[model samples]
Target: MTPYKSKKSFKTRLVIAISIVNLAVILAITYLTYRWNAQQLQEQTIAQTQQTIEQAGTNVSTYMDELYRLTLTPYYNDEVLSQLEYSPTNSRDKLNSKRVVEGFLSSVMTLPRSEILRVYIANDDSLYSYTRTPNDMPDLATYAESSWYNEAKETTKPLFIEPHMERVYGEKPTTVFSVVRQLRSKNDNSKTIGVVKVDADYSGISKICNKINLNAGGLLLIVNSQNQVLYRSAPIPSGLEDAMADGNKIGQSGTITLNGQKYLVNVLSLSNYSINIVALHSYRTLMAPLRSNLMKSIALAIFCIMLADIGFYIIIQKFTQQLFEIVALMHHVEDGDLTVKAHVTTNDEIGYLAESFNQMTEALQNVIDRNAQLAKEIYQAQYLAKEAQYNSLCSQIRPHFLYNTLNTISLLIKCEEYDTAIRAIESFSAFLGGVMNVSKDISLQKELDICQAYLKLVQLRYQDRLQYDISVSAELYSEQIPSLTIQPLIENAIKYACEQNRGQTVIHIVSCVSQDRYSIQVSDNGPGIKPETLESLQQRISTPSHDETEPAHVGNIGLVNIAKRLRLKYGNSASLDILSSDSGTTVSISLPFTKNEVTQ
Candidate 1:
């Protein structure tokens, strides 16, 4: 025998191999754990951001609503409404009316609110103003041409205007959003008197939004429906400005890349005010801690792997000689020489392992011999079981069709139509003969004939109430289809159309060929199946039957049975599809052209 030689000893190779495997396993676990934690943390952050935005939106809405109530203050004061209706021709009466309106507006502004900068009342004849800050008033002559005034006129409710720098306050250039409402005559409510305008600065809304904490470099924006930013904590990025136009583009909360950095965006809509509060959180900043921890974990794992390899090297050195003998025998077994055995010199763990190895090889040889004997039997059993299942599905269709045809004939006889009854009996006999050989497939031509016979029987029973048209090319008729395939579909259309509908029902049977598929469609002009029933039927046909021998007794048994037979014959290459609406339902069966011939 050649002397056994290895470039490296078993102890050194084992220590290296074990160290590499341990390192790989540790890295994979660390990576997966990091990923899971990252996903969970991101989701939590997004959820919290959404909640915060909603709360801030609520606060803003409450503040705006309170401000709106202030605009209605004129209606509460009879003196202000009376002064709004005054239009004096003389300068003395005009000055007195102006004093009354200004006094009322000043009292309204003095209600302990610092945000309300100006209040004004205007009409066709004159304008009055009260200012809490040093600001010039807008011209009453040009006020009606303003966009906010036009919008305010459209509704009786107070209108909240978008933020803009007040043109009248030219020196200070104060940005303000205003509430404008129409002042109507109290005695004649439909008669217009004047309008009240309340201009408030952004300090109130800013205070509400400032409560949100989005970490460093994050932003919170208050925007209108037109995507105009009313307030933002930071300057808008380049692409992010256009992205905010469609809420559907970036849903309520998700991640987006802006300025080469990722961010988490959350949105809350104030529909009543046409406002949205958007929060942006920095993705890099949020995950910085996680990345740092991952790096530390990897460093610790490397150190642990080195320590474990050192300990494993010392332990493996103690028993390598004994294991080497067993390993050599294992090499012989791997080379198909199972007769080789290891020499046992001790009753320790290694000795027991060697004995068990010999017993395992002996048992494996026995199992291989038994498996060869069982394979043939199992295959034959499966073949018989499949055949039985196919035959059983075929048998189920015959009795159901037979019972219905016999009932139709009985109904015809009771109607005193002796000649039609005899004709029906003859057609029923022909249809019965067709279904007699249920185990074999027939050509599409024969299947069409079978469907025609069934339709003829149904047409006789319902007389003029049923009309059907069958159109298929003669060249395509040679394609083979499973027995009882097309007949059941035609029967289903007739039953729901003629039996369920009182009016005349029309059905169309057509066939067409595409790329590599041949499809036959059956459609009707009767009321269609309900959505729930159609879904149940489609599900039953799509799902495979767990028990091959179980009969198709649920949800349109005829359809379920035909679909199953098609699947059994052609596998998934065959399909049954259903389309329906209030107008009608269409059922189509598409089969691969390559499978046009019977598989037997």
Candidate 2:
């Protein structure tokens, strides 16, 4: 009897010891998994956030390039050059000059994005422009002594003048960018006939800077090469002036406290421009998402650990009837059989183990089921999101087509060409019908046709003001593109180039094969964008005045939207770039060259 009692006591003690050891192991595994998952989540979140910011920067740069190429360059070439070259000299010339200047002003005023306040022609001892009355002409002889006139004469190139307080327009302060071109007769290239001066208001620069939406509580500023503020969303403090002195490159990053709120300031230099852009985003905005994600992860980890503990306890108790049942249950759980339950009975050490086992199994099973449901929901949500995006893309086509068609109608009306109008209307209807019925992905040929149709409409609208030269390789016309991709860009080009200052807008649309990709380029010779405007554009910060309907400068929305769409469709495989100078601006896009059959 003594031996029997001793053996039973030993068995009970052994069971208790084994159960405690198993519980400790289970808890350790649960804690480790929680920590590992949390760490991974944190790292992933940080990586994604950084990627988003980087992509935003890339997008801004690309958009700015497009705006510069499509809008600014063409205006400078056609309108400004014509006005400069042909201004009249005699009484008859003076009469013609009045008509030409008035016509030019009318055209400039009609351009929605034109920042030019007025244009002036300086010839001999007379200065002619709509800005001055015949009786109130400013002293033309004294202008050569002024810095702007001297600079224009010195550079022999288009000059963007700095901002200054002016009393000419009113007591209200005004700034202007002046482009002066020496006009000589075609027969006499060496003799300077006259000077054509285009004056763009600084308010236009400010308007462009204001439209970029960087972030909440972030400010975007455009400063000239001289480190003088060309445009700012807000006033700069005197203390920061020394840091922003002429030719000084603002450091890439720094901490700045404004209005008691800390901001992370970043400055990016514009490519091929002498301007610098400064961006200031609140540090709190950057860290808020990270903190929220961390807190949620911690809460989830704690909940998971508590569940693991309860599951282990119940699982141990339920499987106590068999001495090794708890061990077998643990093995099954480890093998991912979260549903396995310990079925044990007895009121001794085994029973206590069984109760713990049941508790553990219950908790783990609940967690597994919840995770499975969550995964299913996430997958469904992703599918729905994709579907919504597709639908949104489909909807965008109609408005664009309608806009182009209406423009065509307007042009036909102006020309009073009834037959051509009818034909164009019919073509537009058929195009719309085909577009709506066709698959989302279309042949490159079809895309080109769409672009041609749109361009025809634009040409009709602008009449003789707009001219385009399209050169596409026959073999490359079958490559696929997202529907309406090139049209928006073209529209943006016409909006800025054709409409600005009655300037002759020349758009060169050319396509070629480069390496393994198909490249398309749109080049224009308009009034080149200000360096500060280009810099502000590259930063993508929405200025405060962007909500105004008629912006004084070109809007960045079309460029940004196109870039984002490209990224969504083609990931990192596609490319877009903009190069601008005083002479012209070029926007180029490249995409993978797939065979026509593959695109279909």
- The prediction achieving the highest lDDT against the true structure is 1
Tens-digit lDDT track for model 2 on 1-600?
354456456545545545555555655665566567645644444454344434544554564344333223324445444555565468986666567655664455324445545556565555656453112224455765666565545444555443443434434344444455555544455655455555455555455556665654455676656666766776564445555663455656556764566666666665444555676655566556555655665555454545554554566544532656666678888888877777656777767787788898889889889999999999999768656664565565456557656876878868899877877777676566656665767776677777777677566556688888888776676677777677666776776666773768898888978667888888787766678877776444223233222222336655554554565577678867767777667777889887453211
lDDT of 2 at 318: 47
Worst 10 residues of 2 by lDDT: 541-550
Candidate 1 per-residue C-alpha lDDT over 162-243 given as tens digits, one digit per residue, 9 for 90 to 100: 7776643335355677888887889997878887888887878887777778765578987766666778888776678766
What Cα-based lDDT does every candidate model obtain?
Answer: 0.78, 0.60
Q: Which candidate is the best by TM-score?
A: 1
User: Residue-pair clashes per candidate, as listed?
Assistant: 0, 40
Please report, as a residue range, the 10-residue window in candidate 1 with the lowest summed lDDT.
1-10
lDDT of candidate 1 at residue 131, scale 0 to 100: 76
